[model samples]
Target: MILVTGATGQLGTAVIQHLLRKVPASQIAAFVRDDSKAANLLKQGVAIHVGHYDDTDSLDRAMKGIETVLLIAGTDEENRVHQHQNVVDAARKAGIHRIAYTSRALKDPTTLVNRLMEGHVHTEQYIKASGLSYTLFQNILYMEAIPQFVGGEAVFERGIHLAAGQGRVALALRSEMGEAIANALASPSEGNLTYQLTGRESYSFYDVAASLTKLSGKIVTYTPAEPATFIAQLMGRGLPQLLAQRITGFVTDIANGQEDIISPDLEELLGRKPTPLNEGLTLLYKL
Candidate 1:
């Protein structure tokens, strides 16, 4: 059976939904920290295993009889890498022959100023050295996150204000990525592989503004602000200083063309063309 960690989150839930289309619910299991959040999965006949990343015993019990485990990247910024290592160790002890992990897709991980990238990098390195066959899906920025990055739907009226400048990202829809991931999971890989899951075309915030203007029937504009000003504005709105800084770093990375990396890997996995930015934006933003 295939076990998917972080099964309650958006991406994990998407994976589960698509996996159910490709395989029987009996063949899929959800490793979740809270069984309460998994009532839907259980109703769908998905076996639920209660466990947390930090809890090795729980992980071991969950890994029992599991042939493959999809290690959804964790959110614990401070201890995520350590927690990921714990899962990897437990998987090894459980004698699982193969594993899969979701990681960030960047041309050069070193150039990142975002602190979260550190966990992805370390986890990848550790997973490689673990002696288990692995499939790494280095996912790109999700189109669903555009709202948070551009100050929400109000940005359609407030105008797009960010430090991203003309930086482009090959952003793909989160649901499409989940479909591709489920496809990969349904047919497990025999050898180690890494797929840079990104859109075939790249787009900038300017493109986003134009698309919004066209789709919403509202005049939307993009105003690139200085990095410091953007960060200060976010902090002024009550975001923690560190979080504000992290967000700024990501946009700045985009400005520097870090997320511009595009690949056919996503489409290849999906068995069809990935959704275009304009179409995805229209679906995500009703107004």
Candidate 2:
């Protein structure tokens, strides 16, 4: 059986759905923190194993009879690494033969300026040293999150204003990444393997501006600003200081070319081209 942690979240849910198409529901198990939130998975006949990253006993219980574990990266930035370690230890103790982890796409994990990237790098190292058969999915920035990076409704109201400067991002949809994860789990292999899942092409904010203009038939433009200025703008809009800093860091990472990755692994897995930027944006924004 395959156990998926964080199964109630968006990426995890998508992965489970794709896995169901390839395997029977009885063969899939969801490791969720709350059973109440997993009503849909229960209705779909998936086994719900309640667990949390902080609770090793719960993780142990969740891993029972599971041969493969899909360790979805956690979101709590401050304690993410420790939480991921908890899962890793539990998976090792459970004697899981195969493990797949979701990590960010970075050319060099050690040199990245972003805190989120740093956490993922630490987790990846821990998993690699655990000696379990593993697949490292170095996922690129999701096109669906373009709205968050580019500013959801605010972009339409103002413009494509960001601190990203002239940086480009090779963004692919989360759904495609989910499908790839499911495919990886289907074929278990020995030794540690890494796949850089990215989009076919990279795009700058100017490209995003152009797409928005074409889709909305309006004269929208991208205005790059200093990181401090962008953070000030976000704060002025009533966003929390910590949140503003975190958001601006993504733009900083992009400007440093950390997110400008273009690879064929995603397309190879799907046996089709990964969704294009304009198409992803149109579908995401309904424009």
Show model 1 residue runs off by greater than 4 Å.
none
**The CA-based lDDT of model 1 is what?**
0.92
User: Which digits, one per residue and each the tens of the lDDT, describe model 1 over residues 1-287?
Assistant: 99999999999999999999999999999999899999999999999999899999999999999889999999998899999999999999998878999998887778887757878989999999999999999999999999878767788679999999899999999999999999998995779999899999999999999999988888999999999999999999999999989989988988988889989999999989999988898788864
Ten-residue region with minimum lDDT total, candidate 2: 107-116
lDDT of 2 by residue, 104-172 (tens): 998656566567779888998999899888888999988898888767867877888888889888989
- Among these predictions, the greatest lDDT belongs to 1
Candidate 1 worst ten-residue window by lDDT:
107-116
Shift of residue 224 alpha carbon in model 2, Å? 0.4
- What is the TM-score (0 to 1) of candidate 1? 0.98
Q: Please, what is the whole-model Cα lDDT of each candidate in the order they appear?
A: 0.92, 0.89
lDDT measured at residue 82 in model 2 versus the true structure, 0 to 100:
97
- Listed in order, each prediction's TM-score against the native is 0.98, 0.97
